[model samples]
Target: MEYADSKCNAYDTYASEAKLYPCLPPVVVPSAPELIRVEGSAQSYRLQKINEIQKEIATERDKHANLSKKYHRAVRIVAGVDNALVVSSMVLDATGIGVLSTIIAVAIATEGAAFG
Candidate 1:
């Protein structure tokens, strides 16, 4: 506009240029807290470790209960077999001495094997 002779055009160009200039001051962003952030990260890690131990304990309890059930089942089978042997012994009492003796020997062998 320096070369222009008209005052009106020069004023319009100056007005437009002034509008491009910044009116408000620059913004200042706040800095983050370094020590506090570090502490918070450590605390979260500790909580995660504690939670993992609790999960392990719950799993162990379930394993123990399952093992107990299997042990009881084996005990029941042993008891049933022992009872059958006792009933058979009673019925064989009047048989020939030789046969009765053989049954008794077999029963003793079976009981010893089962008890072991």
Candidate 2:
């Protein structure tokens, strides 16, 4: 009982609690409130909003397709004009990176490539 503080401190703090009576957990009962949401076709409204978003996405897709077509056409024209450049820098010299770089550069330069 009268052990030195250093020797007693070496044992775990919970040893006292373990020797004593165990603590009991309190029971909890959750109350359910009257979940009445003032709904007059809320799902329809959400659907309408979703449809609008889808339409916007479709419009964006169309714009992207058109822009891609125009970009492809421009790249084709640029490549044709600079066929010698492409040839000298690419396949003829066994380097495809130059051709890919030209395509990317043309798209970036013309598109302004700045999202914004």
* Full-model lDDT for every candidate: 0.79, 0.75
Q: Tell me the tens digit of each residue's lDDT in model 2 across 1-116.
A: 33365332333456553333233457798899887875769978998999999999999999999999999999999989798786677665555677778999988887785652
Stretches of candidate 1 off by over 4 Å are: 1-38, 94-116
Clashing pairs in 2: none
RMSD (CA, angstroms), candidate 1: 19.7
TM-scores for the candidates: 0.47, 0.44
Give one digit per residue, the lDDT tens place, for model 1 in 17-79. Answer: 443434456989999867645587799999999999999999999999999999999999999
Q: Against the true structure, candidate 1 has what lDDT?
A: 0.79
Q: List RMSD in Å for every model shown.
A: 19.7, 20.7
